[model samples]
Target: MGPLIWIIDEEWLDYEDEIRVLEQAFPSCAIKKSGYDYRGDLDKFGYLADAIISQIYVKLDAGAISKLEKCKVISVYGGGYDRVDVLSANKRGIAIAFVPGYCTDDIADYVMSCILRANKPIDSYGSALNDRIWGLPAAGKLRHRIQGSRLFIIGLGRIGRTAAAKAKALKMEVSAYDPYVNEEAMDSMGVRKYDSLEEGLGEADYVSVHARLTSETEGMIGIEQLSRMKPDALLINTARGKIVREKDLVEAVTNHIISGAIVDVVAVEPPSFDEPIFHCPGIAVTPHVSYLSVESFKELKTRTAENVVKVLRGEELKDIASV
Candidate 1:
């Protein structure tokens, strides 16, 4: 019998890309698209499958990993594999793979968009005009030019570096706070490095977050950090939501601790209607889609399927999860 491959999520509208790649490599292999409902028995489903493809929605905890008697790999469809329990998978000799660098440009573009919108406020002016309030909206407001503005980045990873480059092109002075990255590296990119987060927050006109969500990073930005930022500064988060405390953010914006915030992610995705972040006038929220683009979407699907094929063929995995 040929190998069995199970796609466990219903995220995509169609499985054409995954199927094309998997079947082209293993013509006789059985490919099952189970979506979120995998019948009633997970153990039986796990026992029959040789490989699995999943998204962030499904939780593959220790108990679930124990059921994958025949599974060789779990290929995650995006950059994050936090949904899968890495320790459990490793103990079972199961490899976890994810796609990275697929959306670096897309995220950088989105961050730049937020920064531009904060400075321009063109949408607000249009809304005011519709209400018969004429004249310039910035008449009494403090507005700074994009050029010569200070931008502080929380993490200097792939997406962070990309955003720094774009900001530099616009003549914005860029600085970053990342212990993992060396001072020489920042200097090479024409960026200043901050040894402490508070120093950067206090000096920046715009603070963009690109840090990963981990035990060390969760709730990293809260009341204290927000308090350090200038009253007219803006906060931008395109990374994981938990990194920034939603309640504290609401408090800061409401109390005028900082000017406002623009976020592509929230602590809880698809948050309830009463999510205070959504109701606050000082905050603008997007549905966590900073990594989406036509090109990036196709690259994500292709690389995800390739990871599963590599594991099944005994080839070294690409973008193997470290934790």
Candidate 2:
């Protein structure tokens, strides 16, 4: 039989608890780790049997997949396995397991916070005091009483639903756009439903994106669609970057096409100032940590380890979406 596993992911550096859990569970099994230089150790220890587990969002390419001749499974640490070419894995009979709830609440909270910040008066809300301009922007204040305003959600999955619920709690009228959603089911959540993107933009005071990154979703929000939004509307993206074109966002924000904006991710991570996004004012940029929180990170680590062990043992897995 192949060795027990190969772990390839950023989570390896971040989740010691998860590493410990896997170590304890697979004490006698042979495992190779991406960050651990297990390949060099293989020269001394000899190649053991091979199995592989990966944190979600790891590099997924033909070259990477070609190296996994002995891999039988891939356990993604967090949700959104777009980083993995699912069709390729499926064709190779390599089943992939994912942890879905890792960042559920964290992302929901972050999305709501961004929306609130955008709507809140700049002078009073306190985040505009970045000291960049020595607080000149602080002189220009934002105004809001969000209680009666409308919030439109682009996706209606778990995180999307959570955001909608939070918006409702904040007394904001919630509308969602997802043709795939069950009408009766969505209605029970007190969220209004819009079948098209244009409808959502036309009626919303704030728009929060929670969609997945798929072929159908790439660059779904760009100049053409952004033009449909209310002149003073807020656009917030906690979802994957490709959903919105990075260039279009910069142009929109730079030109003040939208009232204000917040993005937890960009189509390109750490986008350059020359790319135009970095030069825009009234836009908040956060390094892809909307899904990160101490509480959620703990849960993510535990779930990741559990999934790894399950895959190694050929056990049934959870959250195996579309594969």
Each prediction's Cα lDDT score? 0.89, 0.74
- Global CA lDDT computed for model 1: 0.89
What is candidate 1's lDDT per residue for 165-238, written digit by digit as tens?
99999999999999999999999999999999999999999999999888899999999999999999999999
Model 2 agreement with the true structure over 1-323: per-residue lDDT tens digits:
23456666543455577667777886765555664233443333323325456655455655455555656666676787877777777776667678886788789999888777666544453444555554556656545678999999999999999888888899999999998897898899998888889878988888999888888889999998888888888899988888988778778877778876888877764446365555678677787789887788888778767776776677888667564
Model 1: how far is 39 from its true place, Å? 8.0
Model 2 reaches what TM-score against the true structure? 0.86
**Candidate 2 residue pairs in backbone clash:** 2-49, 2-50, 3-49, 3-50, 5-51, 56-77, 121-142, 122-142
lDDT of 2: 0.74
**RMSD of candidates 1 onward, in order:** 1.7, 4.0
**TM-score to true structure, per model:** 0.95, 0.86
Off by over 4 Å in 2: 1-4, 10-14, 35-49, 55-57, 121-142, 270-274
